[model samples]
Every structure is written in C-alpha cells, then in structure tokens.
Target: MIVPNREKQAKLRAFLAKEAHALGFAQLRVCRARDAQDREELLRHFINKGYHASMDWMEETLERRAHPSNLWADVQSIIMLGFNYGPDEDPRQLLARKDKANISVYARHRDYHDLIKGRLKQLSAKLLSRLRETHPEGAIKVFVDTAPVMEKPLAELAGLGWQGKHTNLVSREFGSWLFLGAIFTNLDLLPDEADKDRCGSCVACQEACPTGAFPQPYQIDANRCISYLTIENKGPIPHQLRSAMGNRIYGCDDCLAVCPWNKFAQQASEARLKARDDLKAPALADFLAMDDATFRQHFSGSPIKRIGRNRFLRNVLIAAGNSGLDSLSCDVMPHLDDSDPLVRGAAIWALGQISPDQDFAHLANQKQDQETDPDVKAEWHLALKGKTS
Candidate 1:
C-alpha cells in the first residue's frame, strides 16, 4: 500500500499557492472534504422556510450541494480560492443618483464565472500533474460559480474568510468583494485554520439593505432581496419592494458596500475584472431603449446578458419609474407597447409613476383595448384605478 507523505503534501500546498497567485487568485486555502454537515443543516433550514424563492434548483441539488464528499466521494481535500474584484469607489454613492442605473460592481465587468473558471482549470491541471508524478491514481475536479458547491462555507473552512452577517464571505484582505472558486481532489493536503467571525456589534450591513432582505443578523430572505428580484425573479417585481429598489437596475450592493472590513480592500488586480466605463453609471433612459440586438451587443461578455432583453428591460422600466425624472416619461412611454408582456406591464407601471393621474388615465384608456395579455391588462387596470402610488 502507498504510505502518506506529510512533507510532500506540504511542498505541494506551497507550490499550489504560488501557481494560484500567478493565475490571478488573490488567496488560496485547503480543507478536508468532510465536516460540512452544519452548513448542510443551515441550507436545509433556509430552503424549508421558502427563502430560496423560485430557485427550485437548490432543492433539487441539495444533497450534492451540502457536502463535497457527496458530490465526489473520492475527494479528500477541497482547495478554496478567492479572486478580488473590489471596486475603486464606494458603490453606495450612486444610490442617490436616481437618473443613473446602479449596476452591482461584480456585474460591471466581464462574467467572473468565465474569468475565474479558466484560472481554476489551469491551477487544477498543475496540481493534478504534480499529484500524478507522486501518485498515479490521483484525480481532480474544478468548479467556479457554475456548480452547486457550497463555496462560501468551503472557503470559510479553508480559512480564506468568514461569512459575515450579510451571508457573503468577508475577507480581511479583500473585504466583501472576492469571487470564490474550488478545486476538489483525492490528494491529501494540510487544511488551514478556519477564520473566526470579526463582525462584532456592528449591524451596518443589516441596516443598509434597501429592501430589508435580512430576516435576522445572519439569515437572508432571498425573496425580499433586490438581487434576487432583479436577476433571478422572472416575473414582475413585487409592488411593495419596487420603490425601495430605487435606480438599481441589476444587483444591489448596499450590504456588501457597508461592510466595515472594506477599509483593507483594494481595487481588482485583474484588468479584465475592472469596471467598464460605460457601465459605471449608465442612464436609465438609454438602458430602456436597448432592444435585444443592442442589449446583446453591449453586454456580450457581461453576466447581465444572461437575463436576456425582456427581463433586462423589465428591470430598467422599474428603475425608470423610480427615477422620478418626469423627462424620462418620453423614454418609458414607448415600451408600454413592447412585444413582451413582461416589458409592457413594467412600462405601464413606470408610466403611472412618472405621469400625472390625468395623463396616465388617457394613456391607459388608449392602450387598454390593444393590450390583450392578462398581466399587461392588470397593470393598466391598476394604474387607471389609482392603485399604483
């Protein structure tokens, strides 16, 4: 039988860290594939409470997501990697600018899934090659955000960072802006000491939530989250939470931006992860006017493109309605007749917000007969009945 080699494993771990840094990872740590039952219990509790919203996939893949051993039984160690995508300025500063679309900092660049996955593969290959030289039976797997892996918990176990009250990993080195990836392998490696929670009496992340998404200090009600509402929910945004969304068209960053640990955060090291100039503060009117072709062209490599034009325009319409800029009425009016019922419904809601009651009544009457979609018809009825305020 092959014997365990502690010295060889230690050397390999150091080599892996060096390769990870060269591959653009900001931090790297390792942990055993076991010892994830507590996280699994937390996930089950969250799902049982219906906090996952419409994301049924979470329920479907619960077993595989709970622990790495269940995902790949032969896996002996999990390598957690972090890539910093921290912004140069405070993202919260744009919340007051109602005319500008507030896209989340992470979504402002090319998709991290693509950028980080490539690096993970390269690092995985390097580790696999090294392992094979010593043990021919060694095997490996790499995952970015695409998998159901509980990356946050695994990262914490690997001592990369602690999951703060906002539920995202908070790093002393990179704050709340690190992108996480994982490499699971059969090779035994030394695990790092898990990081302790540094969030003392501070509740800044909880109070900063525009929609009060956090039900408690560490619990998140995804259904009430702006990020889930704008990016995950495919239907009309809940009327109760629409006003709170303000001008945020994609994801909300209130909680992440308010973290106290961010004082140590640095701007993203990877140039590709940097925010594009046009996306920093795009006008709501310009975003609303983007048809499918234009939307794809502009956000070709962006995570925003995954939502498609209909869902994207739907979000833009909500931001326009909240903008309170009467001049944007010209931009919002055209979409009232948009082919997509979701877009048209959102446009009607936006119209009511910016237009006078008399003006909205006239427009509603004009569109009422032509609008056959039940959802769009409901929007017109709601606006005409003076129920939109």
Candidate 2:
C-alpha cells in the first residue's frame, strides 16, 4: 500500500511538471511548505539592519512571510516556478551610453506580476482538479510578489536555484533572469532535492554595484542600492550617489548582469518578456520632457507606470544630470517649477550637473524666493554652493 502511495505521489509530481512547462514555465519544483522556515532568521537580520529600507511591509508581515505554513495552515507543499526573461544582449552595455536611459532588463517589457499570476492560477486549478479525484479536500492558492511569502528562499528550497551573493536567485541555466511565482496546496507532493549553493567565491556581482549596496557578500543594503533608490525611494536621489547613477533612470541591472553564470543564459522566449524597442534605450531628453499624461500613456501596461509621473520624472532628471550633456539642461529647465516639489528639486539638481556655475547661481537667485518647500529651497542653496557631493 505504501509503495502504491509513493507511486501516486510521483505521478502527481510528474503531472505538475508537465502542466507547468505547458504553461510556459521554464522550470518547476516542489518542496514541503515548511522547508523555508529557517529563512526567518535571515529575514529578521535583514530587517534589523534596516536593509529593507522604507519597505515596512516586511516587518508588518514578518511571521507569515517567514514560513509558508504560516501563510496557510493546511498547505502541505509549495510549487515553485521559474519563468526565464533573459535578455539577448548584456544589459550592462547600456551603462556606457550616458545619452540613453538604462531601465532594468526586467522592466523593459510588461509587468511580470500579471503575466505570472494568471498562469499560476491556471496551473493551480489544474493541479487541484487532478488532486480532487482522490481527495475532495485538496485546495490551492497562488502568489507572485503580492504576498509577503519569501520567494527566493522558497525557490531555493524547491531546487529552482540558489540565492547568489547579490541576494537574488541565480539559476545555472537561466542565470539571474528568472522571474519566480509560487503555488501552495493542501495535497502532499514529493519535494525535490534542494539546489546546492554554486556561488563558490565569485564576487563579480558584488564588485559590479555602482552604489556599493553590498556591505559584504550575500547581503544587500537597500538604502544604498540604486534599484531601491530609483524605484522605491520617493524623494531625491542622494547627492553622492547621483554621479554614480549615470543614466539609469528606472532600476539597476549591473549586479545581475555581471554574474558569471550568464554564459548559460538564453534570450527570453516569451514575446511579452522581450524588451520593447522604445523602452530599451530611450533618450534622456525624451523622458525629461514628459508630463503626467504623456508618462502614463507611454508606460501603459508597463510596470514603470506604477511609479507615477512625478517619481518617474525625478529619475529622468537624475539621468539627465548625469548625462553631462548641456543640451539636456534645456529639457531639464521646464521641470524646475513643476507642481511637485520632488520634480522641482530634481530639476534644480540636474541643472547643477550640466549648467555653468555662473548660470546656475543666477537661476538659483531667481528661483530662491519663489520656493516655499524647505527641501526645494535647500536644493537651490546646495546647487548654488556646488555641493554635488
């Protein structure tokens, strides 16, 4: 009877793998729901060090995020899926093109949340339907990044990949380009062997960071990370980090792109995952000129749209500042009086980056008395004093 049960479990796992691949998932694996419980300490350590930055949700959902079992009492197993979104060319290549804004490779197309979640639900329904043939109580739930679930650790547990020194999952086959999604089910599934850490002593990812975000190997300081500063941060980019930011207007891909494991990476197969032509390397001037409506229409159906026009413009202005093109100063000038102080402050900083000192001081004197926001006013003073840091 036990042999028959084991055979049945194996068959169910095989069926899951088939359905997952059919749904366009690059890889699939299963693990006990509680397999990631040990990651709680790592999460806590990350939060304790203030590494999560302004993402306070991590603290709010600490317990539930630490263990999958905490998320659902009846969950017996977790199905982890990896969908490859590798780029055809190295994303780091854009870093040298200061005139073009470097958006992260992942954000160069449609948002992964919508693409992955719909497929997760479809797979869950199929799996649950199959399980119900034997156990009527079988049930399932699907999650992308919406929940507090520790996806990277769970993916590691499911043998999908090991979390690299950059603290992002690194797949030997897909490199650092796989997007993760998960399914939780009440039915028992045979867990696969967990993937061993293959990082060894490779610190290429650590050395690639422009902002020195890594305090040490395998840990990240979100406050110093360009991705966090550009995307999650709502205010001005730090003065010291702005020069290092270059023309990266959205998210940073340096660490992920520098992985030695990328030799095995393949171009993304999904049409929606491929980079859109215009977004791949948009000119800083083009982005600096966008207003709210234009920004929305341009980024429609994209993850970049979620950042809103003000924040998006703020990033563009930072890129413009780093472009070292006096031509962009004209494009950056109109934003100096933008309705949002965030944009105005960024414009002030951008001018400091490109405008002549005499011109910057004159403009600072002209705009000084009109500014009410202390932060914007402070920017004028800082720019006038040549405090680029």
Candidate 3:
C-alpha cells in the first residue's frame, strides 16, 4: 500500500501551485478521494424531491457522483482548480434595461469548457511527468464540467472555496465567478484544510431570485429557475413563470450578482474568456430577427449555440412579451406563423402582451385554424382567454 510522504508531498504541492498559476488557474488545492457522505445524502434528497426537473442525468449518475472513489477506484488524491471569470460590470444593472437581453456573465464569452478543458489537459500532462519520475505507474485523469463529478463539494474539501447559500462555490479571492475543474490521481498526496462556510445571516442571494427558485438557503428547484427554463427545458416554458423571467433571454445571474463577496472579484485574466462587445446587452429585437443560419453564424463558438435557434428564439419572444413595448408588435407578429412550434407559441404570447387586442384577436383568428401543434394551439387559446378576461 502507498503511504503518505510528508516531504515529497510538500514538494509536489508547491510544484502544483506554481504550475497551476502559470496555467492561469486562480487557485488549486488537494483532497483525499474519499466518500462525501453528507453531500451524497443531500444529493439523494434533492433528486428524490424531483428538484432536478428535466435533468435526469443527475439522478442517473448518482453513484458515480456520490464519491470520487466510485468513479475511479485507484484514485487517492483529487485536485480542485478554480478559474476566475468575473465580469467587469454588475450584471443586475442590465435587468432594468428591458429592451436589452440579460445574458448570464459566464456565457457572454467563449465556453469555459473548451478553454478550461485544454488547460486541464496541459496541467495533467505536466503533473503526470512529475509523478512518473517517482511512481512510474502513477495514473491520472482530468475532468471539466462534462463529468458527473461533484465539483463544489470536492472544491470545498480541497480548501479552494466553500459552497455559498446559492450552492455555487465562492472564493474569498474570486467570489462567485469562478469556473471549476478537477484532476484525480493514484498518488497519495496530503490534503489541504477544508474551507469553512462563511455565509451568515445574509439572504441576499435568495432574495435576488426572480422566480423564487430556492426552497431554502442552499437548495434550488430547477423547475422555476430562469437558467433552466431558458437553456435546458426543450419544450415551451411554463406559462405561469414567463412574466417573471423579464428580459433574460439566456441564463440568469441574479443570485451570483447579488453576492457581497463579489466585491473582491478581479476581472477575468484570459482574453478568450472575456465578454464580447456585441453580446454585452443585445437588443431583444435583434435576437428575434436571427434565423437558424444567422444564429449558427453569430453564436458559432458561443455556449449559447448549444441551445439551437428555435429554443433561443423562444426565449427572445418571451423577453419581448415582458418588455411591454407595443411598438415591437410588428416585429413579433411575423413569428406567429414560425415553422417551429415553440417559437410560434412564444410569438403568440409576445403578440398578446404587446399588440392591440383587436390586432391580436385578428391574427389569432387567421392562424388558429392552421396551427397544427397542440401546444401552439393551447398558447393561442390561452392568449385569447387572457385578453377577454
């Protein structure tokens, strides 16, 4: 059995810190690959309550996610790394600008999965070389957000940061805007002291949620979350929650933006992860004009491209509906006959919210007979009912 070597481990830890900083990782720490019992129980409870919503993958990977050992049996050490991607401006300010889309700060740039994964691979290769010098058979594996790794809990265990009330890892140095990655290895390494939860009596994050997605301080119900509704849900967004979504066309960042700890956050260091000028606060009208080809070309390397044009347009129409801008009626009315049912449904809602009652009624009458999708037909019926009532 491999035993811990204090002197050798100290050297390895120092080497990792130096290497990680050179690779643009803001923080790095190590922990044992043991079972996280409390986290496992919490995850099981959350899944049992169906808080995961349409994300069935969370329930499916419960065992592998429950403990690092379950994922790779030979794993003895887990290294948690943090990459700060803090925005230069407060995202909450954009909420008041109803004409502009409020995209989450992280999604404003190149996908971190692409940026951080490559960096993780580079760091892993260097670590493997160092390990081979001593333990020639040492094995290593790196993971970004793709794997079923409980990155937050492992991060806290590694002393990288504690999971805040919003359930995202928060660092003293980087605050709420950090991207996490992990590396698991067979070599026995000394674990750092775990970070203690510092949040006390602050309900700012919970209060900032527009849809009240949090059932408690640390738990989130994915069903009502704007991020889940806009980015994850493939079907029409639930009608009841549409108005509360406001102008956020993509993921929402209210909770993250409200954290007082963010006062310490530094702007992102990597140029590739910086926010694009055009994406900062795009006009809702501009997004509604994007066809599939235009959307594919515009969001070519963006994380938003993954949601596809239809889903994206669905979100844009929702924002337009909530904008209360009657002048945008002409722009929205054209989408009433959109090929995609989700876009048509959202267009119906937007037209109802922004168009004159007579105009909406006339269009509804003209299109109602040809609307094939049950959901789109239901949206028209609901809009008409809402108008008359």
List model 1 lDDT by residue over 13-76, tens digit each.
7898899999999999988886554457878999999999999999998888888888888988
Each model's lDDT comes to 0.89, 0.88, 0.90
TM-score list, all predictions = 0.97, 0.97, 0.97
Ten-residue stretch with the least lDDT total in model 2: 1-10
Superposed by TM-score, candidate 1 places the C-alpha of residue 265 at a distance from the truth, in angstroms, of 0.5
Q: Candidate 3, residues 1-389: lDDT per residue as tens digits?
A: 24357887788789989999999999999888864443578789999999999999999999888888888889998889999998999988988988889899989989899989999889988888887766778778999988989899999989988999999998998889999999998877788999999888999999999999999998999999999999999999898999999999899999998899998999998998889999999998898888889999999889999999999999999999999999778788778878888899999999899888887788788888888889889999999988888
By lDDT rank, best first, the candidates go: 3, 1, 2
Q: Give the lDDT of residue 52 in candidate 2.
A: 91
RMSD of each: 1.5, 1.8, 1.3
lDDT, residue 14, model 3: 92
Clashing pairs in 2: none
**Residue ranges of candidate 3 with Cα displaced over 4 Å:** 1-4
